[model samples]
Target chain A: MATVNWRTINIDALDPDSPANFDLSTLTATVAPVSTADVQSLAGQIRQLLRGGDNEGALQGALENPPYGADERGKDVHLATVIEILQSIRQSDMSPMLGRIYKSPGGTEALDVLMKYIYKGMSQTNAASTTRNITPQATGFSQIHSRGGGEGGGQAMSVLLSWHEKVVEIAGPGCIVRVMTDRRTV
Target chain B: MGPPEVHHLFHHPIADHSFSADRQTLAVARENNVDLYQRAGGKFQLKDELTGHDKTVTGVDIAPNTGKIVTCSQDRNAYVWEPSPQGWKPTLVLLRINRAATCVRWAPSETKFAVGSGARLIPVCYFEEEDNWWVSKHLKKPIRSTITTVAWHPNSVLLAAGSTDGHARVFSSFVKGVDSRPEPSAWGERLPFNTVCGEFLNNTAGWVHSVAFSPSGNALAFAAHDSSLTVVYPSAPEQPPRAVISISTQLLPFKSLVWSSESEIIAAGFDCEAYRLQGSEQSWQLAGSLESKGRPGVQDHREESALNMFKQMDLKGKVTDDTKLKTVHQNTISTIRVFEAGAGTVRKISTSGVDGRVVIWTL
Candidate 1:
């Protein structure tokens, strides 16, 4: 008698990637797609607000409507605007800004959107550092840090990390879980 | 309340479990087989095993009115087990799908059942008297990914399905011959077969793990992978829902949830412990964990001897032994079902987990 080890076989590899097998429409956002021009205009407005020292307005504008249905380029533009707004806020004003965002109508959802951008910013910075291939200085007690970063990149990472910490402190850990599990792109 | 009653079965994950209407027999889906345990002297003894599926059994449900058992497996097949004098006889269901069946639930009327599958469709199977076999009609439209879990409405016509596409949808599985015209409700009127009554996406578009209809069939609740439970109350047919309340928890995501009543829901999953959420259709909040921690004598059971402390420090480089969690279930809970109900409210509930322990909690 002969028996085949069906479990060990790569069944998924054998199957063709067809629409009937996996529907792509379900994975995409149901919202209408955002055009590149619209994203650019929004980025310009957010940049103007940032320059005017309206950090809260800029952050709120960046988070109010995520480019859920945008293409990769459009989403990247929106993400860059969000990071610029996140970086413009003073360290002391971070808690108060988050508190105001949390207290406002639909503030919790805005915070969740902000969290998604924060994670995206962190990953992009990390990726840039890796591509640059900057060697770490072998200082005592700091060699234990595994993430590679240059001096400028490390400061940016610290800012993002502190924002992440404070976001979790205000929004609770659910924001992190939401950002990690959410499939809809920012 | 007192501590929950726990029975540690064999060391294997139980994907799903169901109790008979009389609550005398318990059926659990273990690895390739469905094991039946008889309730004897306040303990469950292994009675028999229904072994037919070649792959892992994903779901098992026992019909309440009729003592029939329905089991679906990852082998892309389903079986309806009928008790006979000789033994339990298994009848294969013609699912007509090429992918694994992930979950199964018998309709309240016991005339039909729905199987959620990786084929991105739900096959509503009903017995054909003339052919003397179980035939299925697929609900294919609007379903995008593998269905994770399915639930039947109290009327037996409406079915709710949760899928990996981050959607919980309510579809009419009204088989023309098997099911009668259901009464008009918030879901819809003149329910035809494959009618899309409602579709709800999770807040962050997380994969929905479990979806359930309320006891009254007027509301729907689903647990998603983002550690949130959302409850939707349909206002009127073709209109927006009156309320879609999502309660996010700090704990791990819930894999299974059951409505104890119209106002209360008990959910358990990766948290290893069950939690209770209570409120109305307008708003809801997490009440707390069902487990009452720091029970008397539980703390005393841990031995803090110097030798044990030294052994712990030498082995794991830690002074305290934190291997054991405070919760009863040592691993992720996979399923939660109502064990006993009275007067439209669940009195006791049962939960099984990866720890191979079945616990009964009085709510």
Candidate 2:
């Protein structure tokens, strides 16, 4: 047998950070560390709501306390961990846990409630926390490494946006595309 | 053009598939076993399963004339299944390689077949009357890495192999006493066993994912990992090729392709939809996607209500609910084969994908 030198080329290392094309600069804004104390207390309540399996209640708490502040790393960590847990709950099930909720009565209303919470929660992180933007950007798989970069407001929005993207991706493009092309509402 | 017929046979990824001559039996490589489905009431139902390999079965092909099935697996083995009254009988071919057999295909004559392997070799196998067994002759000289795909020439003597080493080569597997002397062609004139007839590499050093010979066997086309398809046309035996047309597309790399005609090639891959490429020996370009641009008539739109909004929000944490893709296949399309063919042209094509769907498209 003739000897041939073989080499393995990793497709990722050739072009790293292919998924960082999303412009997050406009999405991020600095927040003054004014409401740090209020957000921390609210996080405790959200934790209790999450433990009670009340996703809607937890979403409501997040919306009310919306954790926006500079130097509020403690609250940011708490909220991010909560979102991570919710995301896991949505993922671990065979059908999306949220999809089941959507099929249930008032599921859309609950989703809208959660959506409202997510909108506020996205703006809950500190603005000056751009230094904590150490999360590796997604390459292909929608695996978020850290809560997104934010003073406090952007991380929640990022999580919400990413969640929607993941759901759309998993559900096939039809779910959202059909919604976009529908003339019934008009 | 109604929607293509779809057979969602299994939940696992179908690595490869083949249809029997009568179009009744379908054999698919699913995990470690090859599952055969027979068409009944316009739908394929499970008929039998061939289980022998210890690892994942990578490729399967049915010889239409001989009514034989050949399968290879990651377990470094290939089995030829001959149909009998007692169902299909499996006979292990003496491949004598120590690496995973990636792909296998019976030649046009059904007398021989080629197995591409991770051992960096293409074994051209033929039956031996004296030994009463199938034995292979390894074309092991110039290949540098694992062979990903193989295609046999229409004459059944020349074999084309694509490898991870970023090269696609044409080797003469003209086994003595088995293959008669082929007429002079664009690939070569004088051919012998293991003769390297032609070798070509992609400009970007991309690993070739698939290789195909045009219906006439005068042209060769290969799809590479760089999302480009290169078509090669040779001039004469020792002369340089007349044209090497490389069309780099913006789409993902194609995993499989087949000649719709001498002038058209249909390819599909990670995009989950087939695309038509039209060309001559001088030039080639992507025509369009084989799928309809969009589904305009099938309206399943739910009335927009506060309830729907909340449901979307709760389930997907969004106000918009768009989960269904317009494409028939929801994932990567891995293989495309000619379903119905005429001389140097195909009328219908069948595609199987990672989503466990087998869709048949008409030309």
Worst-scoring 10-residue span by lDDT in model 2 chain A: A177-186
Taken over the whole model, the C-alpha lDDT of each candidate is 0.90, 0.77
Cα error, candidate 1, residue A122 (Å): 1.6
Against the native complex, each candidate's DockQ, computed on alpha carbons, is 0.44, 0.02
Candidate 1 TM-score, true structure as reference: 0.87
Runs off by more than 4 Å, candidate 2: A1-186, B296-306
Kindly report the docking quality category of candidate 2.
incorrect
Give the fraction of reference interface contacts each candidate recovers: 0.56, 0.00
Complex DockQ, candidate 1: 0.44
lDDT of 1 by residue, A131-178 (tens): 676446656554345354466777888889999989988888777888
TM-scores of all candidate predictions against the true structure: 0.87, 0.67
Please provide, for model 1 over B1-363, each residue's C-alpha lDDT reduced to its tens digit, 9 standing for 90 to 100: 667989887899999999999988999999999999999987999999999999999999999887999999999999999999989999999999999999999998999999999998999999999999999999998887899999999999999999988899999999887888889999999788999999998667899999999999999999999999999999999999999999777677999999999999999998788999999977898899998978664573576899988988899998766678888999999999999898999999999999988899999
TM-score of chain B of each: 0.96, 0.96
Docking class of 1: acceptable
